[model samples]
Target: MKEIVIGENQAGQRFDKYLSKYLNEAPKSFLYKMLRKKNITLNGKKATGSEKLKEQDIVRLFLSEETIDKFSQVKVERSHGKLSILYEDKHIAAVNKPSGMLSQKASGSDVSLVEYLTGYLLESGQMKEEDFRCFHPGICNRLDRNTSGIVIAGKTLAGLQEMNEAFKLRSLKKEYLALVEGVVSSGAYLKGYLHKDEKCNKVVVEKEPFEGSVPIETEYRPLAGNQRVTLLNIHLVTGRSHQIRSHLASIGHPVIGDGKYGSKKSNQLFCDSYGVKSQLLHAYRLTMPELKGELNYLSHKVLTAPIPSDMKRVLEGEHIEESIHE
Candidate 1:
């Protein structure tokens, strides 16, 4: 027999949902069965599946001790590698994932950021494979293959749910810095729908879709501009596949070194003259509400990845400053 008391954070959630976080080893069927048999009670009374819980509700469970022991034996195994940890708490970890690394395991790849992170947590002794039975860790959002910057992963199931909700509600904000060819109007807003061609691995911007296309909106402002290139700050109001790339290209200011949506001539010129390799884009900042009240105001973090060597060379040749901001 065990007693569980709900906290403020756990309030207003379903009973089965709450139990799932704590008794990770127990399947949903088992939980419902226990509830049917009166083995689970709230405030000393039997609970129904439809019962809405309030703050400070007390739940009690009657189960054999042996079952609990079996759950303790379950372990989660992981593999690790070089990763930069930007922020961490008991519930979540935020990292600055580098380019060329898959966020999760792809069809053919063996090593991924998730696998690396699991190994990191295990090696650091913050968690054991067995502990994972009670908590499933996973990345909440994704970045492109070559785009780099802050990526968040949940260390616990509760954290994952919370962060996922935050994203869905648009309570989380992300900002990016991109270098595009040609100059853009100051404080210009670009809006359009994007259709991705999987066969060609490119996104096409159109005012209307032929059949299967999604709506995407991207707002960009020219932070700095010169005769040849413009640096813009991009905010994605609606995240769709290749929204930024496709929208920017539609406006005739394709990003520098973007072979797919940009001019091949410009890409070759930059690569040959400056030795630049991937598109010049970086996730610059992220903001989210604090999980705990002690940190009251919205928590905002800024991340800066120095311009790649190839891009730096071009900027140096152009005599640009080390830092450029609006």
Candidate 2:
């Protein structure tokens, strides 16, 4: 027999949902069957799997160790990479994720930023290995594999839920810095419809809506530039796959080194000059909204990540530093 006590992370969710996460390999039908047979009980009584779990609630499972082991999938491999932390608190953390790091795993063996966060928490004695049974700290936002910048992580279940809600509501404002081809003389608020081609992993922005297309909004201001290139601060009003790159391209200002949506000749020029092989885009800033509860400390706060060395070199070479703010 196994007894699972609901903790902070495990509570506030449906019993069936919790069961699925705990016994990941077990089928929903099998879990329902076990519940019906009284093999799974809540607080010493048979449960219907529809009950809401609360902290300190006891869940008893009348099953053998072998059965439990066969159903649960628990694999923890600590990441060795050192994280560049921007800000951290008991509920959440913000880190500067460099280019070429995955926000989450693409495969079972892949190590991502989430793993690094886990490793950091463990080494700092902020978490225990056993604590992963119910909840694990993880990134709430993601950046492209080649794009570098700020990433937010939730250290506790409440933090995760609240942060996720804020992002979904678009309450948190996000900004990016991009070095692009051609000069942007002024700021503009651009709106368009976007259609994504999944097979090609690219998107097209159009002035008119197409079938299956979604509306997108992007705003940008020119920080500094010359005739050949420009540095711009981009405000991502509506986050979508490749929105910034594709939208800017539509305006004849494709981001340098963005092979997917940029000019090959321009990309080669920057590649040879700056050794920049990926999109020269960085998630620069995040402005917190009026938040409540545990995350209220971050309310109305603005977080920024410094310009990467590679991008900075290009700006310096272009002599645009005089017009840039900070």
Give the CA lDDT, 0 to 100, for residue 226 in model 1: 76
Model 2, 233-257: lDDT tens digits are: 9999998889999999999999999
- Give stretches of model 2 more than 4 Å off: 1-4, 25-48, 60-71, 107-109, 322-326
Evaluated with TM-score, which candidate comes out highest? 2
**Cα lDDT, all candidates:** 0.72, 0.89
lDDT for residue 274 in candidate 1, whole number 0-100: 82
Q: On residues 121-208, what C-alpha lDDT tens digit does candidate 1 reach at each position?
A: 8888877665554355788877777777777887765667777766677667777777889967586666667778888778788877
Clashes of each: 3, 0
- CA RMSD (A), model 1: 4.7
Alpha carbon deviation, residue 14, candidate 2 (Å): 3.0
Clashes of 2: 0
Give, for candidate 2, the lowest lDDT window spanning 10 residues: 317-326
